[model samples]
Target: MGSNGSDPPRPVVGITAYGEHARYGVWDNESVLLPRTYPDVVIAAGGVPVLLPPVPESAAAVDRLDAVVLAGGPDVGPDRYGAAPHPRTGAPRPDRDGAELAVLHRALERGIPVLGVCRGAQILNVALGGTLVQHVPDVVGHSGHNPSPGVFGTVEVALEPGSRVGAALGPVATVRCHHHQALDRLADGLVVTGRAADGLVEAVERSGAPWVVGVQWHPEEVATDVRLMTALVRAAAQNRTTAP
Candidate 1:
């Protein structure tokens, strides 16, 4: 339904898409349009999904949505977060890199509810002047974080008391992991809310914002995981209603 000034505005979430190729050696150089499972998660939680395509200008993309989601994808460029490439770091997609960074920067400035997942989490950190551990196995020398490539691993996360994510997800929660990269140097105002058994950071949220959280897990992969998407959609709904 359209907002006619009498009705509340429906929350719109901008989800970032990924680029693809046949092989690392031969770049297909074609935009790969894939749907993120999170948008369906958002829809199930009562929000609208606006696939935020790779745009040259981020501000314009961010302006159309009340909230934004940085979906999981290829590893972020090492140089972006002030690090050198690791053997495990996937080749960077420049188009996605430019689009997401733009959207993240504009979303932060606009006070939009931004949820970052996996690669999305890393993007959030980099956009906010933070860094990442290129390869968890290489740095931590452990396989608990990600046991199998593209497969979900079960891990318990201890949530910090008084954190938004903690409150939303209760004192603690067992979330699914699929990425090798993890949060390292936290961005300013971003407080680590959840951590894995290996002491790797799993979740982060803005200190003062109503909603700005990033998780190094795949909540969307599990439709039963409602709290994460619910919290996001709720914040987006509220933001849209109160948008000036």
Candidate 2:
């Protein structure tokens, strides 16, 4: 049924998009793009999805948003965390790195709810003085977390009871993942809330924020579950209602 006139406005949630070379119809060119799943999940969770392209001033757009989702993409530039790029690390996208880092900081400064998925989780860590594993197989001795390109692997994550991620996803979740890097040396004020059996950090959240969760898995790829996104939207709704 449609909402009555008394219903509140849907919260606007911004999802970051990356610039990439692509082809469509008769033209092949660089494009600002994001997977459709990100917006679809946000909409399913009762939030309006807005795509934020990687631009120097994109951070300013956060001022008009109720929440933000740092969508998954390329590996965060190793230099962002004071490290040399691993031989396995993909080439860096400076524009994307700068834009996302700025956007994340602004969102936190304003106390906006944020969800970081896959590469987004890595971005969250690096944005807050943390480092990354660089290559997961080197540490875990297996490629299960990221079996192959364009293919998502399923990994079980154990959530910490009472944590925001756990509250939304329960104690254990079989999540979709597709990344070779994971959080390491967590930034101050960020707590690990979920982990894989191999002890890789799978999720983290800001200690004092109302909602700043980052998951190493790709929740958007898990079409059957919308709990994580729903939690973010609900938090955004609450933020909208309580903002001064």
Candidate 3:
């Protein structure tokens, strides 16, 4: 099913990957990793996926991409926002944090469409001078958002009407969530677009253009819902066609 020189080219989406030590095929080594679900959703949404490893120079690649996705990972360092690390906070991955912040800043400058999932969303906030709650259960008084290891909890998020996220996910959505931290103070030029019943921030988006959206939940975890990815792909396509 090759293109007959008619349809537009598929947008190239760059997704950030995690650098972790893993055991694979009897070999234990450090590797760049990302779940298959991220690329799978991108492809299903008519975009080509490229994995961006945590490297200082990775931000340079944003100029060559139509859009970017910040995938979920470990908790961001509290020092990023001048806060002391909470007892429950995960250790920082400096390489990942620096690389992602660079990529995000670059993408925003280029007006590239960006989607942040889980920790990706947190990265976006911290990069813009915002802070995180550090531990959700401490404030929310429950562990429903992250029931246990390797298990995703279901959360009902109320979307802000007329928001970009709402346009893609509708007024209310039952999302797959697995996070222990969430946005505390939103950055300038960004607004909260979704929240859980407990008033925890679940989604945020830029107030103006370029199509930046971040969700506390992992949209890729839900195979049945491709709306969010589709929306990103569509924005990327538009960016590709309109870029001067």
Candidate 2 residue spans exceeding 4 A from truth? 1-4
All models: lDDT?
0.82, 0.92, 0.94
- For each of the candidates, give the backbone clash count: 0, 0, 0
Tens digits of lDDT, candidate 2, 1-244: 1146788888899999989999999989999989889999998888899999999788999999999999999899999999999999999999999999999999999999999999899999998899999999999999999999998889999999999999998999999999999998999889999999999999999876569999999999866789999999999999878888
> Which one wins by lDDT: 2 or 3?
3
Q: Candidate 3: where is the Cα deviation over 4 Å?
A: 1-4
Cα deviation at 156, candidate 3, in Å, is 0.3
TM-score of each: 0.89, 0.98, 0.98
State model 1's lDDT: 0.82
**Model 2: which ten-residue window has the lowest total lDDT?**
1-10
User: Residue 116, candidate 1: how far off, in angstroms?
Assistant: 0.5
In model 1, the Cα lDDT at residue 145 comes to 72
Is 1 or 2 the stronger prediction by lDDT? 2
For residues 1-244, write the lDDT of model 1, one tens digit per residue.
Answer: 2447986656888888776544435555566465557678878777788777777665587888878888888888888877888887888777888888988888988888999988898898888899888888877787877788666888889998798788888888888888888888988878888887778898998887659999998888888777887888888777767778
